[model samples]
Target: MQLLQKFKLGKSKKSPSKGHANYAYTTARVRAMKSKILPKETYPRLMNMSIDEITRFIGESEYKEDIDELARIHDGVDLIEHALNRNLAVTFTKLLSISEGDVNFLVGEKLKKYDIWNIKTLLRGKYCNASTEEILEAIVAAGRLSYSFLSSLAAKGTYEEVISELANTEYYPILKGYDGTNLSDIENQLDKMYYAGLFGTIRESKSKDRKLFAEFIRMGIDLKNLVTLFRLKKSGIADPEMMNLMIDGGLRLKHRDIEKMMPLSFADFVSELESNPYWDVMADVVRPDMVSLIDIETRLKKHRLKSAASFSHVYPISIVPIMDYMLSKQNEISNLRIIVRGKAANLDDDIIKEQLVI
Candidate 1:
C-alpha cells in the first residue's frame, strides 16, 4: 500500500518541462529488454507445437511469472492470453517507472493507447452486459490509467456510471457523447484524439530524434489511412465524405492525394497506390482482385517494424531505440498470441504463418 501510494505520488505527475531525459540509462535498459524478445526462429517452432506444448514453452520463458500467477484461474489458451496481457502491462509500466523527464512523458504519450483501449473496453463490456472479470481480462493496462481505476470503471453498474467516473479525464468530453449507442463512433473519435494528441506532442518538440520520431508517426498515419481507404473501397463506398476517416499529417501521402483516390474503383485505387512510396512495402501482396486486405495489412505492419528496427541503431541514446524496443516487444507479443491462438483454433499452420510478422 505504501509503495503504491508512493508510485501514484511520484510517477503520476507529468514532467513540468522538457527537462533532461535519462536517455542513456533508459535506452540501455531498453536494449537489455529487447534482447529477451522471442527470436525469429521461435515462431516456426511454436507453429508445430500443440497448445499444451506452446503453453509450456512460454511458461518456461520470460512469461513464466505471468503464467504461474494466472495459472490457477485460467488454463489452456485463456491462461496464455491473460498472461500475455499481464506481461505486456507490467513491461510497459516498468518502462514508465524507469524513465524520467521527457522520456517518461513521451513513453506515456505513446502508451496512452492502452488507457484509451481500457476505456473503450470498459464501455463496450458494459454495453454488452459482460461481467467485470471478463472485461478486466481484455484489458492491457500499459498506459497512464492504472488497472485499479480501469477495473473500478469496469465494475460500474451502468455505462452512465462509467462515464461519470471518467468525467475528470481528457476523454470525458467524448465519453459524454456515448448514449449507449454510437460505440463505433465514439471509438473512432477516441482513436482520432489519440493520434491528434501524439502528433501535437511531436510537433512541439524540435529535437532531432523527436523529429525522426515524428516521421515514424507520420508513416503510421499514412498506413492507417491506406488501410481505411482499402476497406472503404472494398465495401464499395466511393463517397468522398469518407475522407473524414482520413487523418492529417502523413509523411508521404497527403490529405489531398487521398481525397483524389476516394472516388476511384478498387482497381484504380491499386493503380494509384503504385505511384505512392508505400506501394513498395506491400506491392507483392497488393492486387485489385485480392479478396482480403489481410496480406496488405500484414506486409505494411512488418515494414513499419523493420523500419523502426533499422532506425533504432541510427540514434542509440534517444527516444528512437526506446520506441523501437516498444514496437518490437509489441510485435513479439502479437506474434506469440497469433501462434498460440491459431493453434488452439485449429487454424492451418500456413494460415497462421501468413498472419505472423516474423
Candidate 2:
C-alpha cells in the first residue's frame, strides 16, 4: 500500500520552542474527569431503555445537572439535545479553565473548530431564514467564542450583519466573500481554514507531545478525506471536482496521493484503499456497492477514539491523555444523544448499536 509505504517516507519538519507547559496537573485532572464518563457497558442498557428511561438514566449520571437545569423548559429528545449541547460546552470550557500556558493554548486551538462550527451554523441558519431559536439550538459554545456571543450572532437579522459582527476576527476575511448564494463555499473555506490554522499551530512546535498530537490530527484528516471521497464517489461527482473538496496534509494520503486516487472509479477507489493503513479498521465495512457511508464513517470514528486512547498510554503525562479524554467525553455525549434521539425516532436497537462508538 502506497499509503502505508508513504507513512515511512518522512516526518514533518519542526522548529524549537522555548516556552514551557508542565502538563502533570492538567493530565491528572483530565484523567479524573475521564473516569466519570459513562462506561461502555452502559450503552447496551440504554439500548433497552425507553426514551424516558434513558433520560432518567443520564439524568442521574454525569448529565444530571444539565437535565435538572433544562428540564423545566424542555423534555424528551429536545431536552436531551439541548442538555447534551450544554454539557459538551461546559465540559470543553472546563478543559480550557483547568489548563495553563501552552496546554491551554493547544486546547484552545483544538476547540476552535467549535468556533468555526458555530460560525458556519450561524451562516447556514441565516442563509435558510431559520429562526433564531432554531439556529441557537444548533450552537455548541465549546470554543473561545461564548454561547451568548454566538446566540447574539444567530439573532442577527441578516447574514451580512452577521458577517459585519465578525469583521474584526480572523474569519472575517473569508466571511466577507459570502454573497448570499455562496453559503456552501463560505462553509468549505471556513472548514479549510481550521485545519490550516491547526496544522500551522503545531507545525513549528518543539514539544514531542504536540508532534504526536499532529500525527493524531493528520490521521483525523486522512479519515475525513476518505469519507469525503466516498461520499462524492457514491454521488457520482466527477473526480476533478473531488480535489477541491479534499483537505491538504493527511498523515498517509498526501495531496498528491489523493490527486492520483481521484480519477479512479469507485471500485478502483475501494481497491486503492486496501493498501491504506485504515483499511484494516474499515475493510469489513467497505465495499464498492455499499449502500451508505455511515457504517464506514462510524467505524472510522471508533478507530479514531481507539487510536487516541492507545496513544495516551504511551505518553501518559503529555497532551495525548488530555486529547484522549476530550475525544472520550465527546464520544460519550454523542452516544447518549444517539440513544435518546434514535429511540424517539423509533430506530431499531441494532441500528443504534451500530452507531455507538463504545
lDDT, candidate 2, 137-227, per-residue tens:
8999999999888988988899999999998899999999989998888888988899988888788765577798798889889989988
Shift in Å, residue 225, candidate 1: 1.2
Residues 262-301 of candidate 1: C-alpha lDDT, one tens digit per residue: 9999999999988999988888888889998889888888
TM-score, per-candidate, Cα-based: 0.93, 0.92
Q: List ranges where model 1 is wrong by over 4 Å.
A: 1-18
As a whole number from 0 to 100, the lDDT of residue 25 in candidate 1 is: 94
Highest lDDT among the candidates is held by which one?
A: 1
**Candidate-wise lDDT, in order:** 0.88, 0.86
Alpha-carbon runs more than 4 Å astray in model 2 = 1-20
Highest TM-score: give the candidate number. Answer: 1
